[model samples]
Target: MQDEDFLRRPAAPQPYSLTPAILYLSSDAVHATHKLLQRAGRNESCVFWYGERHGDNASVHSIRAPVQRSRRGNYHVEPESMSEMVRDLRAAWRPLAQIHSHPGVEVEHSRYDDAMVSSRRILSIVFPYYGRPIANWPSDIGVHEWQLNYWHMLSSADAMARVRLREFADVEVRDFR
Candidate 1:
């Protein structure tokens, strides 16, 4: 094989087919995620949404916060930490999204975030104001998905169609603080 062919990037991501097209989240899930991120104050923190998927629809049934090192602008979760956090979760559960906090309203994923995301097959949602979340649900929040070769932030209209926050839904919360 030519050097160019050998050096070429891996095949384009498989379109994340295993992920649901529309994910329904419970208000409690949002509340729990915000609460965990807020505890870090000015530092950025992260959590994960894990659940089951049925066809194009999925419901978030669990929230998990890995033991991560948070800074004002970035956070890091060791692979081992992530594994330990999810080890006890239901065997059938799959991670739907990784929810993180930013210091400002710039919800766009940073270069660091793009590289640090746990999985290309899952969504990545970023909240502003260190997760205090001044704006309404989904508003000002950055919902990102991996497509082609990049992480694309969904527009408001797209976000609405993709993720819905219900007033009430059952969600189990686990934090590795």
Candidate 2:
């Protein structure tokens, strides 16, 4: 579709619920995601993750979708690559969520994004990669959970706060020096 498809805002707030209770992200995983989005600039970039979800905690361990140049754009993921990535990741780790960057500051899900979530009920995170990367992330991120009909965008503070809650207390972030 149009280049700004992903940038558009939704018409109305849709019903949604946070799934898996807790999400634990590794430092390396966050770093790699930031780097990929930065390199892509205004264009959209994404990464998938494989993790273990037990009761209320989901421990994300590794990145399943690597940066592939074949589908570099501001609004879409290459169909072929996406298909292959999902297939490959499903074989090993459960596809927990899809992380992407927005060219603009708006972090809400667009209509296109809602349509994309048609059949899959997964978590979707939109990062506002506007300025310099910072050490803190809870203050500048968008978290959305797919419900039966629509995606719900959680408040940035709430999302971060939830992640920092006791459920994700034992996460380990590996330092790549």
lDDT of each: 0.81, 0.58
- The list of candidate 1 runs beyond 4 A from truth reads 1-20
Estimate candidate 1's RMSD in Å.
7.0
Pairs that collide in candidate 2 are none
How displaced is residue 1 in candidate 2, in Å? 3.0
Clash tally, candidates in order: 0, 0
lDDT of 2 by residue, 1-177 (tens): 465444566554554444447777766667666775666555676666556776676667656544354122344555665666555333435656777676666666776666654236457877775322654576576777755555777776558744542233332222111
**What is candidate 2's CA lDDT for residue 75?**
47
How many Å off is the CA of 20 in candidate 2? 6.9
Itemize residue pairs with steric clashes in candidate 1. none
lDDT, candidate 1, 38-146, per-residue tens: 9888888998999998878778999988898888777889989998998898987898999989888778776677777889988899999899956566868988889
Model 2 whole-model lDDT (C-alpha atoms): 0.58
TM-score per candidate, chains pooled: 0.86, 0.72
